[model samples]
Target: MVAARITVNGKETPISPAAPHTTVLDFLRERGLTGTKEGCAEGECGACSILVARPGVNKPTDWVAVNACLVPVAALDGQEVVTSEGLATAGEPGKPSTLHPVQEEMAVRGGSQCGYCTPGFVCSMAAEYYRPDRCAHADADGHTDAEHGPNGFDLHALSGNLCRCTGYRPIRDAAFAVGTPTEEDPLARRREQAPPAPAATEYTQDDSAFVRKSTLEETLRLLRERPDAVVVAGS
Candidate 1:
C-alpha cells in the first residue's frame, strides 16, 4: 500500500516513521516546524494552533485554525496544513521573507507575546483575516466596540488563545488595524477554490492503526465488519 502523506507548508511529506499515536504537535516539531507550541496539551491555551483548509460557508474553502496537540498525525493523512512559518512569503535569496498581514500588524502594534504564544496568536488571527465575510458589512459610522473592531475584526476569533505576559490591548490594536487582503494575496485567493477531499488512508505502525474511508457507505460497512472500531470525525 502507498504511504499516507500530509501536505505541510506547501510541501508533501510522508507521515511514516512516526508512531501512530503521535500528536500533530509532535509530528510537526519533529520536522523542525517548532512554531507550534505545546502550552496545554488539552487544547485550552491555543498555543498549538495551526490552520487547515476546510469546507467553507461563504467560500469554497476556509482557513480554519485547529489544535495540533490533540489530533493524531494520522488523522490529517491527506490534508493540507499551514503552520505559522507557512504564513510568510519567501523573498529574494538573502532578503527576509514578507510577513503575513497578521504577523505584520502584531509586530507593529507590539502584540507579540512570548516566543511560545506569538505564533499561535498570529495563526488564529490569520484565519480571521481571511474570513470571506469579515469585511462584508459596514457599520454606518465605523464605530469600534469591545468585541468588534472598526475593521470588522471579531475578538472571538482569538478567544481560544491565552497569554500571560502580553495583555490583550496591544493585540486588539493589531487586530483592529489590519486591512482587507489585497487582490494578489495568495492565501486570500485560495478561498476561491474547494478544499481537498478526504483521502482514503490506511496507516499502521507497531500495534496501532488508522483508517480513513473515502465515503460514508464505506465507513458504515467497515463499522459492521469491526464493531470494536473507534470513530473520529474531521481528522
Candidate 2:
C-alpha cells in the first residue's frame, strides 16, 4: 500500500497505510510535532486547535482554526495545515526562529499558566490575528476599547477554547495587544498570496477509505452509496 502524503509545516509527510483512522492530532504527535495538544477528544475543549487553509470566495484562501483531534489524517491530503510549531518565522540554522505576533503577545502579557492549553490558544489567537477584519473595530486612536468597540476583536472567537488556570483576562489582553502585523510576517505574506484549495481526492488503503468531494454530485453519490458512513463537518 502506498503511504498517504500530506503537507505539514511546509514539508511533505507520508502517512502509513495501517492507520487510516488516524486523527490529525495523532499524526502530528507521531512525527514529534507535539505543539498541538489534545485536552478533549470530543472537539469541545479546543485544546487540539490548528490553523487550516481553505477555499474562500472573497479571497484566494481563508484561514480557519479547527480541532485537530476531530479531523482525520486522510482528510488532510492535498490540504495545507499549520500547527502551533509552524506559526513562527523560520530562522537560520544556528539562530532561533522569531515568534509569531500572537505568541509574543501571549508571552509578554502573561497569557499562559500551566501551559497545557497554551498551544491551542496560541493557534486560535493566531487565526484571529490574521483575520482581514481584525482591525475593523479599532477607533481613531488605533486602539480597541475593552469590550466596547464595535467591529473590534471578537472575544467569542475563543469560545471553543478552554484555559482553566490562566483565566480569560490575560488571554484577552494578549488578543488586544497583538497590534498590526508587519509585512515581514510569514502569515502576512500568506494572507496576500494563499494558494487555492486543492481539488477533491480519494484515499484508500486495505478495506478503509476516505473521500473528499469537490462537487455536490460527487458528495451525493458517496452518501447514496455509503448510507451508514460517518460524516464530519468543519466550520
Best-performing candidate as measured by TM-score: 1
> How many Å off is the CA of 57 in candidate 2?
5.7
In the predicted model 2, the residue pairs found to clash are: 137-151
lDDT digits (tens) for residues 1-235 of candidate 2: 3355777887887766537678999999888999888787989988899988865445566678889998788877767789989988889999999888889989988999889899999988877777776656766777766662344567777888999884778898888767776777666567666664554757777787777788889898999999987776662
Please list the C-alpha lDDT of all candidates, in the order they appear. 0.90, 0.79
Query: Per-candidate TM vs. native?
Result: 0.93, 0.85
Residues 119-232, candidate 1: write the lDDT tens digits: 999999999999999863346675566888878899999999998786689999999889999999988898899988877889998887888887889999999998998887
Whole-model lDDT, model 1: 0.90
**Worst ten-residue run, lDDT, model 1?**
136-145
lDDT comparing candidate 2 with the true structure? 0.79
